[model samples]
Target: MTKFFLLLSAAAIAAPAHSQTSPDSDAPEVVVTATRAAQPLSEIGQAVTVIDRAEIERRQTTVLSDLLATTPGVTVTRNGTVGALTSVRIRGAEADQTLVVIDGVRVNDPSSTGGGFNFGNLLSSSVERIEVLRGPNSVPWGSQAIGGVVNIITAAPTEGVQARANAEYGYADSVFASAGVSGKSGPVSGSLTGGYLRTDGISSATSGTERDGYRQYGATGRVGVEFAPGIGLDLRGYFADSRVAIDGFPAPDYVFADTPEYSKTREAYGYAGLHANLADGRFNNRVAFTIADINRDNYDPSFGNDPSFIGRGRSERYEYQGDFRPLDQVRVVAGVEREDSRFNDGFTFADTGITSVYGQLIVKPLDVLTITGGVRNDDHDDFGSHTTFGANAALALRTGTTVRASYGEGFKAPTLYQLFSDYGNRDLDPETARNFDIGVEQAFLGNRARVGVTYFNRRTRNQIDFRDCSPSELTTPGSICANRPFGVYDNVARAEADGVEFTLALRPVDALTLTANYSYIDTENRSVGDDFGNDLARRPKQTASVNADYRFAFGLSVGGTVTVVGDSFDDVGNTTRLDGYALAGVRAELPICERFAVYGRVDNLTDTRYETIAGYGNYGRAAYGGVRLRLK
Candidate 1:
């Protein structure tokens, strides 16, 4: 109450700032990943973050994972440089527990041995915006959402004819270039983008000195047509081909040399959808179909044979959703979906299918109070049925302050490899999670400056772990043991994680902007094992970042970022240790003309050595200069 009164007094003093509010402002922009329908970020109860294309371009980051690492509640671990295997974890969840979506399609590889999305090959050249929703949100997204969701939106035509191109050169003999064209004509709008990059990257093994190279080419296209006043048809497609050098496992001594090994990856993703607005725009309906396919070929000529392994996977999904606003202050959303997944390796094939239905409601009964609730039912081909639910509330105080809380359930079904492979266990149950969060925020300077704090807790049950089993244990008819010496996946342990996240954004002057965030996570493994009572592997206890940018009157912009990552355990047994590290970077841009700009970036300013993964090597100081052209 005291804070509320203080804010009221501030509002009165700043009454002249009332003209700063707008629906198109950053704070009021519509976000869809939270509830499957567009809602202003200021009205959302869940913790969400949006990174626009302007910020992405200003950072001059080559890989998408680099942009995500600085986000609060997110941690990225890469085995090597770009094109190497990379994992992203949110809120202390495992890598596989988070889901990645591209234009409403789940893109996680079904055939991956780890059953997770590889962030190494993802590029930002064709992205318009990215939304990261933290915490359990499995109601709209079926599986692999125990942690959170990363939703990527591809670029689209905004108005008249437009074209843009970029080219850059950097360290390790790397080169990057991209071109795009977009336009709107009458009832039709479309965009096409293409990019190619190659890098002679640093070594992967900590003790190795040889370089590992990578190359990739990709294209993205989208077209949308309006059939009637409020009806539309959309089509989207993406394809990529790349080859990356591989570093084999080390010997018992945990030291090795780089070898002549590489793997080729090919991917194709497509989406088609139709949307309509009826009943004077009070009712909205949309139907979409999506497909994701991937193929991989591996070769190690140094091993005598020309090849080692080949893999294939595919997934398809069909969905329908509806949003209704029967009352002025109430809204409802409902949806149904079906998805199929398949994995193949020459002689063996595995498949799974799932069907689900979900519903959510939002109501504002009181002038200052808003409530949201949702539930979902999933029916799996092998696991029968499971139910999940979520609830949230938010209150807006008179001083432009807000308080919010939420609780949600999450579940993830076992992968095909876990259920039907040589070391599979068909009796393994789906992993379940219970998560909750509470937060408060206060606005200063008429929303120009803002501060917020959030606390979150999540507990998971029936976690799958692999352990050695004796012959007798494997011989039993009804057991959780496999015959292979590598052990089998089985429900073994439980886990709980709690964390606090803080964020601040301030525009103290018209030409300068500053932002900072910090996150602290504490994890507990409550199962009897070597890792019991220890924190999860690679989950740091503290991570913080600070960034500032300033623009001069002469069309020059300068910015820098400082990042700190605390110490963490690399192995589950808490044996291998990784020391904490801090890194700094700087960037600058100068506008040459209204439609063209020149920029330069320098990373690892102080050349601080660090390792996100225990045995992997990170690049030292690197410099890059690029040119950008835009015409509309």
Candidate 2:
């Protein structure tokens, strides 16, 4: 890690030294996730990052998590290889506190112990855009927005029939393919996509020999119809069936290998929406219904023959949203949401319901200043009601500098598994966070270069964790064992995280773009005694990334990415530490024709041996190449 940082410093000293500028006339279009409404990137007061379609295709990523791991202020922790339990944390927050949204629906699994969205099976084939809004944004987004929001937006229908296909083959006998089509006729538009992926991955445990394999088949479809100039109806559906090998306790040789334990998971989601604008486009409304279902069956071929059904979970959501511009300089957005979650194990079934109402106002009293404020109230069937608030401000000075600041309160309800599982505790309270951030950005050299620095702080309370309360301490009324009995979840953990983020973007030439970002995070576990004042798990003190790309003539391009991560602990008490490392990759694309192209990438150029988890396997030097075809 030290050598890596030294190299990074040398590169910075030798380069033009800046980053990709915030969206401007020379940049991309407006983004909708930052404000819950379409707005330019520079007009928002929050730290939001957007990875668009072009960038996605340029990278030719296999999974959604890979792309997120390269961004600033985010961390991806995996148990072992692909298809394993992968968790994404933003700025030292727990996995469950970060919300994942596909289109307009929150997709956290209620059956999971933490009620967090798993990043294992999310493919990048059908996604057109991904916007990561950092910090607590609980006003527009509801519960579980304590850390931030990852909005995966899919491809919208385009005019005329357009088709695209992709195929890739790489090391470890990995294979990937995807085909998709989209079209629009008059007022009707639709899109359909399908993909398949398989990989023979390495062992879960470092000492294991046998390989673990994974495969996934998925499809997505969407249709839209416009009844008027600014009115539309839309329907969408997505499904993925994945088979993955997993690990449990170690064997006699202390290796978690030679096990025939695997799981097959089928996840499905459906959504329907009615969106329209009325009264000369001043009032806009959207009514949507979403359904998310997950079914899993665990199997141990060593004991039986075929995979057996293990568990099933489902979530249904309904929402009504409205945006109105009462005055030229004032806008208001409000929404009402209700969600139902259920889980069944073929015996004991549990369910819960949550309802919420939220509203926000945006006022632009001065052309150079913007103000935003919002409030939200949520009622959980199991717990009582809770309220949240958020506010933001942005001011643009005439000297080509912008100042921004924001503060928000966030909360997350307990999951069904946490309330009804074997270690369930019915007295748990909702987790909460108080978040604040401030920053200033300045553009130079005809807006071709930009540099910014931001400081953020978040405090979390009422965190839940399981504990054995038997030895000379508190005990439950029920009895199962004489000496060791009580084990239940409790809200006894609190956390504090503060960080500074620096960004630089510069387009020194017409065909070359350079960007760099660095984050310094200091965290303390202010929990109820145990592990108190300790640094959080899997959160490194510093993370930095640099991206450089130059497009040449004749439809040829080359790009490279480098990331450096600092050392950090891997457990609650900081007993286990995972050494940090550096990763480097280069990519190139060659256009075969007007509608055909071949692209390849080499990852882990240094093959630096490192692990994110103590006993997990790490990916080494690997290479992959593929072709793309477009028909219109």
Local distance difference test scores for all models = 0.83, 0.83
For residue 574, give model 1's deviation from the true position in Å. 0.6
Compose the digit string of candidate 1's lDDT tens values, residues 551-598: 789988877776778889997878888888877777888999999999
Instruction: Report lDDT (Cα) of residue 323, candidate 1.
Output: 96
**Which window of ten consecutive residues has the lowest lDDT sum in model 1?**
14-23
Model 2 misplaced regions, further than 4 Å:
5-29, 250-255, 306-309, 472-486
Writing each residue's lDDT as its tens digit, candidate 2 over 242-327 gives 98887756456655555667888888888999999998989999999999888878887766876555677899999998999999
Give every collision pair in model 2.
18-504, 19-504, 19-505, 19-506, 20-505
Give the TM-score of each candidate.
0.94, 0.95
Whole-structure CA lDDT of model 2: 0.83
Model 1's TM-score against the true structure = 0.94
